[model samples]
Target: MKINIQNYESYCLLYIDNELSAAERREFELFMQENSALVNEFNALQQTVLTPETLLFEDKAILYRYDEMEASLPSSFKQSLYREEAKVVDGYFTRTRIIGIASIAAILLLLLGYQFYFSNSINVKNDKENRQTNNKSLKLKSSKDSNNLVRVDANNNLENNTLTKHKSEIAKANGSKLFTSNNLPSLKETDIISQEIKTQDIIIENDVVTNTISSEVTNNLVSDKNAISINNNNSPILNNTNIPSETTENYNTINTDEHDRSIYIANFEIDGDKLRGVTRRINALFKRNKNDKQK
Candidate 1:
């Protein structure tokens, strides 16, 4: 009698048909009052009473069951397809066994095919590599033969003479790079150092003409900070140089001045003396001054 959303529908149908008791009818009336939106639904239920319809099929013969219409296999075909007295069921190959054997045979054939193809590919690659190596050797040999068999005549036409069958080595000025390998030991530290030094002291020009360059040129090259006093004795001679070629009649490039250069140390000036003599006099002066101070 206490109708909810689920049981209210049945209660409403019972109320519509007057099949509900007084208590259920009162509860359903209260439910309908609370849900006034479903009044149309209640009112529409009476019109929804579906009457039994007499339906007629236009193709009534299709619905009829006939003996010939029932599909069935022929006796011989049914006997062939029947598994009841089958030979395979009489302790022979089953469906599972047949399928397993087929899979095993497929795998075996694949393995055998792969092995044959692998072996053939390896053989083909080896044959191709061997052919290439042989062709390269033959080309080198043919080129060498051609170079050695070159005709001596300017027009390269040998009229009567024929080449000797015996192999002969002709000395060629321009030829392929020939490798001359030696079994020398690894270079030591000293050998490496000597090789580097030899490479460092390479002379680009072996012959040089020595011209008499005046002292003015040498003085111009010298800075005031590094001034040098050279007397006429040394003549600016260039030593350790290659001997002048007879073809060039030029003199030595560095030529000393005719007069000696004056040497100045602070206010004191020393002239007309060699460097060694000037150094000795300066030392003697310092010694005398020390002796005087002691006395």
Candidate 2:
């Protein structure tokens, strides 16, 4: 069994007081004899406990003076101490508040900077997209203009062919030798068409002859060549003296007398009384239809 060194002092004190039994005293003496160092330490401890140094009492009042001196301390001294402590605490709190505010400001600044950077990047991206779109639009417009030019050239060729056919038909109808190889010099189709169009414009500007001559010529030219016809419903119709009898019969057969009558009536001048009569007849017809529906 291992003996605890902490209990050695207690064993020695018990042995000196003769409180241990013979078996315990014999075991303690055997333990001390085996540990010679513990025996010397125990003897010194026993001497110190049994004969301690004498304590002098020259200043016995010093022990009881501490409480009274503390009680007699001035209130101002305590207030000053408390004030100093409070100042230290207040400084610590102020420094903490300053740090917190600085951190918050820095965070806010970072957020604002990020937002500005994001907005700028977005605007730049939008600008790039806009530029790309504008470039595409320009390319499309250029392509469209080229296509239009090709279409215009094709249309001009078709118009020249139609004009040549018109010129031949007009020459035959008028029984004139206008396009004869000997009489007129050979001209380009464009030049001939342009000259004809100019002549027609001049004739149109002359109001006195336009209603009679221009309408007949334009109608004959359009009908014979199957060209685009003038849609002027108000144009006056003249007697087709130069037109072939077969052509005249075809025109008359295709259009009914009722159609001619309607055209003539549309062109005819009407008085206010006739217009009022027409309105009254229309109102009576509407009223009759409404009554029939109800029945």
Candidate 3:
């Protein structure tokens, strides 16, 4: 139709968008030529032309304006967010706390172990020194007393004889009474080796319809040469009944029968009446710290 200044902008938009007919387009071009000053406006409107949209927003649900919703932070996050406002949340022994406690316990264990070992060693050393001095004094006294005593018979100086013998026995027996765990073997002489149980698998048929095979286990060490054979009726019989040889040698505990099971600490030696309690523990620990130097 007739293109005016007001409608000319609309015509230019149609032309930029390629929505005008050929006749309308020619008329729009001729109007632009008549108003050469408005050509800049048409050029600006052409720049505003939006290209065809390849990507489209399919979801119309989120586009609708909704009411504001109340938001809440997690308790853990709230505790961190508000320093003074946060109450004492009882997070009973968190992983970090447990780890810290465990670390302290381990340190305490090492400290206690060190104290027990060193203190016991010192006590043992003092006892040994005192014991040696006492033994020497007792020996001197016993010899002199024995030389002076005039025993007419077995009954004469019975008290003196008993005391002398007891003193000598006590001097000779320098070790303290030692106690050790039954399961744990001494490291001094025991050579513990892990042994594997060897096994040989024998195929035994379990078919009920056809040839059914029967298997028998025996304590006999020898296996039959003709272990598998077809019977007269065509059913196979497994005569192999020998148990594995390695199973027999399986031991529940380390065998200390070969030698006397004496408690001996490899690192340090403490001569006393008998090794017992903490001393015996030290003896056991010797096996674990085998590399420790002999002191």
Residue by residue across 1-295, what tens digits does model 1's lDDT show? 3778777667767886789888877878888999998788888885676667999788988778988778888899988877775454444686555755665565565456545645655665555434433332232232232322122222211211111111111111112221111111233445434433432121111000001223342222121112212222322221232322212122232122423654333334435246445445645655665687689
Instruction: Sort the predicted structures by TM-score, highest score first.
Output: 1, 3, 2
Q: Any residue pairs clashing in model 1, and if so which?
A: 211-252, 211-253, 213-253
lDDT of 2 by residue, 1-295 (tens): 3345878888888888788888888998898988898877777766755655798898877667575566765889777777433343355557546755665565565456545645655665555434433332232222222212111112333343444344444443433323321133333445434544444332323222223344354334233333322222321211211222212221122122232222112234334354445546655655675687699
lDDT of each: 0.41, 0.45, 0.42
Summing lDDT over every window of 10 consecutive residues in candidate 1, give the lowest-scoring window: 202-211
| Poorest 10 consecutive residues by lDDT, candidate 2 | 144-153
Task: Provide the TM-score for each candidate, comma-separated.
Answer: 0.22, 0.21, 0.21
Q: Can you tell me which runs of candidate 1 are displaced by over 4 Å?
A: 1-88, 148-295
Pairs that collide in candidate 2 are: none
Predicted candidate 3 versus true structure: per-residue lDDT over 1-295, tens digit per residue: 6998989988988899899999999999999999999999889988887787899788987777655544667799987877565587769897656755665565565456556665765676555434433332332222222222111223324333433343334323322111111111221111111000100000011011012211111111012213111222221111232212222221123233434333234454433323334445554555444544333
How good is model 3 by TM-score? 0.21
Clashes of 3: 10
Best by lDDT: 2
